[model samples]
Every structure is written in C-alpha cells, then in structure tokens.
Target: MLIRLGYEIAIDCPQPMPVISLLDVHKDRQHDIKRQTKVLTSPFTACDVYEDSFGNSCRRYMAPQGGFQILYDALVEDSGEAEPCNPLAGETPVEALPPETIVFLLGSRYCETDHLSDLAWRLFGHVPPGWARVQAICDYVNNRLSFGYGYARATRTAAQAHEERVGVCRDFAHLAITLCRCMNIPARYVNGYLGDIGVPPDPAPMDFNAWFEAFLDGRWYTFDARHNVPRIGRVVVARGRDATDVPLLHSFGPHKLTTFKVWTYEQESYPVRPPARGIDRTLTTPLIG
Candidate 1:
C-alpha cells in the first residue's frame, strides 16, 4: 500500500533563533520511502541535517526574524498490515538484555519510573509476565486516563498524569512507558504520523501522533495505550527516553507559533509531478509579539 504523509508548521521570531526539528522520516524507514521532497522552508533558511544519538534524523537551522515556515510531504510504501500482536513474546531478563536497551528501563524526564514503581508493582505484580503484562498495563492506562486535547500538558510527568487521570496521547505513552520500566521492561517514546486509515475519519484537525515501543523477546515491539488496538500506517519520526528527548521543535530562543498542521492518508498513486520542497506554505502572516 502507498501512504501519503507530511506536516506544515509556521513560527515567528522577534530576532534570529536557532532551532532543531525531528520532523523528517526516520532513518530506518529510508528504504521504505518511495519518493519524498526535501525539507523546505519559506524565505529559504539554510539547514543542516544530522542523526541524533537515538538515530532520529534532526534538521537544524536558524529562523530569521519575522515569519518562518516549514513544509515536507512524502509517499511511503507500506506492507498494508497492522502492527503485530504477539502474546507469547516473553520479557528479557535485565541482566541478559542488550546494553543499549538498558537506558529505556530507567527513569526519564516525563517517564518517572521511580515514582510509579510501587504502584506498578502493586497493580501488576501477579498479572503474568511478558507480553501479557505489557497488555495489562496498556489496558489499565486506556481505562485510567480520559483523552482530550485540553489535557495535553507539555510538562506533565507519568506520575502526574496517573493522578490527574486526563491527558493526550503523549501522557498515555508516558504512563505506560514508566509502568513498563518499573516492571523491568525497556520502553521508549515515539512520535510520528498515524493517519486514520482502516478506521472512521476524525473530524478534528490532523497532527503528529505519539506511541511507544517496549523491548520484548530481544526486540522492540510497538504498543499504544491511547488506542490499545493494532493500527496501520505508523510512520515513525523519532524515538527517545521520553518526549523531552525528541520534541518536534526545540528552539533556543522564544518564538510565537502561528500555525501547525499535519496530514496523512492512503494514496492510490503518486502525484503527477513531485514538488521540489518541504514544510508549511501559505504562511505570510507578519510576526507579532
């Protein structure tokens, strides 16, 4: 199957601002891309692309004072299969696990495993280990938190989210990742495009999506506490210990965000002519305080 996906974002700065973005297709998916446009910006800001420690492609550039915009679109090749469900995938012992995966088993900025450890143990101690245990965690989180855009708190931590019982997809991912770590499972945060395919269309505006991956059976497997069901067309952009590590945009100076938009869907075929760029267009708005 072919999937079309991309994002358009516009921001304004009073003066020059250095920023980094993780909006490009992940390096692992380079082979899966049929064709894509280069990351493009309005007013043409020079950019340098680099791979972060987590292996996510990072685009860096300086936004000139006034209005700055970014746009990127792509057609990706997918197998047309939902995420795999493996109930028999057993958890790897801490000592026997990969050295790199150990980082995910510890605490992080948003995923406070230390604070959630006792609760996780008390709630899932006897739920049977391995994939079943992770599913149990997802089920609990899916039922525990109320979903909505209003509950999206950038500073919200896993413990805080569990107490509030309200949050967006990142919170669901944070809580689930923390609980998994407390139970000695390596889990990491992921953000990317998840179009509403093979499901009812959503009336709300589209935006980038958040989910997570847990190390099980010597490999990482996808899981989503927010949806708690297998989903199709998951195009990953970045992975980190938590949202802190891979925020879509990290600006060194303050800036006003004027627009943010995203799109993804099943594409029957490619565009007649591939566009020569990337990022948000039609952002002629003047900068404001």
Candidate 2:
C-alpha cells in the first residue's frame, strides 16, 4: 500500500509575540519495511530547520519562528513494507527489561494500581520468566477497548477512560500504557498520524492519530490499540513518558486557541520512482514547556 499524508498546524495567539520553535518527525525511514519517497516541510515565515535522530533513531525536524501566525505543514509519501520481528519476546525477562521499557514503566503515573496489575497479570501469566511482555498487553488493549470519536476530554487518563468505558485513540493508548507500566512492562505515549480509515475528506478539519510503544525484549515496538494492527503510513512524531511529555503543540504565553483542525488522506497510486536528493536532515530539540 502507498500513502500520501498532509498535515497543517496553525496557531492564533491572543497577543503578538516573538519566538516559536517546533519539532517535526515526518521523514520516512529508509529501511526494510518502508521507503520514504518525498517529504516537504513548509513554514509560513522564514525559519531555521535542523534534523536529528533521537532515542529510537527516528528522524526529526526543528524550526524556530518569530511573532504570530505560526503555521507548519508537511507532505510525505510512504510505501507499505514489512520489518523483521525483533524477536525479543523469546529471550528477555519481565524484571530485567531494556531502557525504553524501564522508562515506560516509570512514566505512567496515573494508572490505577489494581487495574494495571490485572492487565500485567494477564500478559505475564503465561510468559516464560524472562521474555518481553508487549504482545499480550497489545492484544488485550485492542480486544478490551471500543473505538469512538468522543468519550472524554483529550487530557483524561487511562483510569478515567476505563471507568467511563469509552475513549478515542489517545485515551486507549494511555490506558494501554498505564497497564503496561503497572505490569512492569515499558510503554510510552506516541503522537502521529494514521491515514484516512475510510473517512470522507472534509475541508478545514483536523485528523490526528495516537498510539503507544512498548519496550520489550530488546527494542521499542509500536502498537495501536485503536487499530489492533500496524502497517505503513503510521508516522511517529513525538514520544514521551505520557501525553504531557508529547503534546502536539504547546504555547508559552496565555494564548486562547480560537480554532484547531487536522486532516489525513491517502492517494490512489504508489510512487513510480525513488525519493529525491537534498532532503533536509536537521534535528529539532523539543522544549518541554
């Protein structure tokens, strides 16, 4: 499968200000499973952009701007390719996990103790003493949660979503991460895009996707509780201990958000040629605030 994605971000600040920086992770990786054909980042104003690879070796772009009317856009094409399974599931132990796994366990601070432990038990009950525990948890989350557009606020936690019995992608991811952490499995929050899931395109609308990553056997594995399956066109932007660590965008001053919108779509054809040269590879350091 081939996918073309377009993303637009606009910020309308309450007052005119100076200095704005953003980290973008849209460059498709050149690996076995997928190929990035083309990627273009457009800013409304003049800005400096840099590229760097972070913890997972994913490419990221950074831009710094001045004043208001901050707009960022990117276009990317990715081909559906399968990657080799890490196979960490067979050798690593639950107690002795990787760094990524450890971080995930410590990041989720709001998951209910009993609920999370129950999930961990479900995943670990059948596992050999020293193996990765992500697949079971992923399956459980996918089976347990129902995908819906509106169930709670964007900032709601896994415990809240579980009590309410409804949640969007982010909520589901959070719930899964919380459970993984509770189980001593490492899991983190991921913000990015999932191409149009048979939805009609609407002008001036917003469509962003959220998922989670579990640290298992020896590496970070991507899991989508909402989709239950993973494939290409799944671009990861920012990842953190929780939602607070990887917000889509943050403002320093008191800026009333007047409007926000996102849209994702797929093209009918695949790329006929390879990617172009001279693609910017500058890394942008994220500012937590």
Candidate 3:
C-alpha cells in the first residue's frame, strides 16, 4: 500500500531564531519513498540537514522575524503489514544487552523510571521478562488512562499520567516506556504518522502520533499503549530515550504556533496519486528542506 503523509506548521517569531525540526521521514523508511519528501518554508531560509546522536534526521535553520511555515508531503510504500509481534521474544539481561541500547534503559525527561520503578516492579516483577511483560504494561496503561486530545499536557510525566489516569497518545507512550525501563527492558519513545488504515476512519483532524519500541530478543519491537493493538502504516519520524530527544520542533526564541496539520492514509494501487499541495505550493531545495 502507498501511504501519503506530511505536515504544515506555522510559527511566529519576534526575532531571528534557531530551530530544529525532526519532521523528515526516518532514515529507515527513506528507501520506500515513491515521492521525495519536500520541506518548503515561507519567507524561505537555508536549512542544513544532519542526523542527531540518536540517529534522527534534523533540519537546522535560522528563522527571521514574522510568520514562518514548514510544509512537507510525500507518498511512501508500505507492506500493509501490522507491527510484528513475537509472544516468546525474551528480554536480554542488562549485562548482555548491546552497550548502545543501555541509554534507553535509564530515566529521561518525560519517562521517570525512578518515580515509577517501585510500582512497575510490584505490578510486573512476577511476569516473565519479555514480550508478554511489555504487553502487560501496555494493558495497564491502556486501561488506566482515558484517551482524550483535550487532556494532552506537554509537561506531564509518566508518574503524573498514572496518577491523573488521563492523557493523549504521548502520555500513554511515556508511561509504557518508563515501566519497561523499570523492568530492565530497554525501551525508547517513537513519534510518527500513524493513520487510520485497515480500520474504521477516525472523525478527527489528523496529527502526528506517538508510540514506543521495547528492545526484546536483542531487537526492538513496536508497541502502542494507547491503542494496545498492532497497527499498520507507521511512518516513523524519530526515536529517543523520551520526548525531549525528538520534539517535532524546537525554537530558541519565543514563538507562537499559527498552523499545524498532518496526514497519513493508504492509497489504492494503479491510480498513482500524490498528496494535495498546501496553499503555499512552492517546493524547496535538496528535496528534504
């Protein structure tokens, strides 16, 4: 299946500002792109692309005062398969886990392992270490919190989500990631375009989504605490210890978001199509802005 996806975000700044955006389709999925992802900026500025320490592609540029817009649209081919699952995938011992994967096991800005460690152990220590345990954690989070876009909080941590029992998708991911770390399973936060394909369509505006991946059987596996079901067409945008490491946009100066939009949907074959262009339809350089 072909997945058409992209976003348009506008920010207003009072002075020149440095900004980092992680909106590019992840490197792992770059090979599947049938149409190049393009990032167009209004009142354009030159942008340099580089991969971060965590391996996420980032765009750095200086934005001038006034309103600035970032836009991208592309079509990517997907296998139309749901996230893979292995019931018997076992967890690797900390001593045996890859050195690079160690950081994911520690606490991070949004995932507070120290605060939820006790509860995590008390709730899941008895369960076998592996996929099943991670599923249990997702089950707890899915039932514990009520999903609501209105309940979204940018600063809420996993412990807070557990106590509040209400939050958006990121809250669910943070809580699940924290619990996985507390259990000695290396898990990392993930954000991307997850569309309502092969399922009933959601009657809401499309937006970027967050989920997570836990290292199991020596590899990472995707898991979504919000839906608690394997999904298809997850075009990953970035991954890190927690949300802080992969914010969609970070500006050094004060700014106000004037516009935000996202899209992701499966396309029927033989009709070769491209995503509809934004109002400011001018395309930019390097194919990836």
Indicate whether candidate 2 or candidate 3 has the larger lDDT: 3
Local distance difference test, per candidate?
A: 0.89, 0.55, 0.89
TM-score of each: 0.95, 0.67, 0.94
lDDT of 3 by residue, 142-177 (tens): 999999999988999999999999999999999999
Candidate that scores best on TM-score: 1
**What is the C-alpha local distance difference test score of candidate 1?**
0.89
Better of 1 and 3 by TM-score: 1
lDDT over C-alpha atoms for residue 256 of model 2: 49
Query: What's the best-to-worst order under TM-score?
Result: 1, 3, 2
Return the lDDT, model 3, position 31.
94
The weakest ten consecutive residues by lDDT in model 3 span 280-289
Worst lDDT run of 10 residues, candidate 2, spans 280-289
Name the regions of candidate 2 deviating beyond 4 angstroms: 17-23, 26-68, 72-77, 82-88, 94-96, 109-115, 122-133, 197-206, 268-289
Q: Write the per-residue lDDT of candidate 1 for residues 1-289, one digit (tens) a residue.
A: 9888777788999999898999988888889988777777887999998988999889899999998988777779998899999999999999999999999999999988879899999999999899999999999999999999987878999999999999999999999999999999999999999999999998988889999999999889999999999999999999999999999999999999998978888988766554434333452311111
- What total of clashing residue pairs does each candidate reach? 6, 15, 0
Return whichever of 2 and 3 wins on TM-score. 3
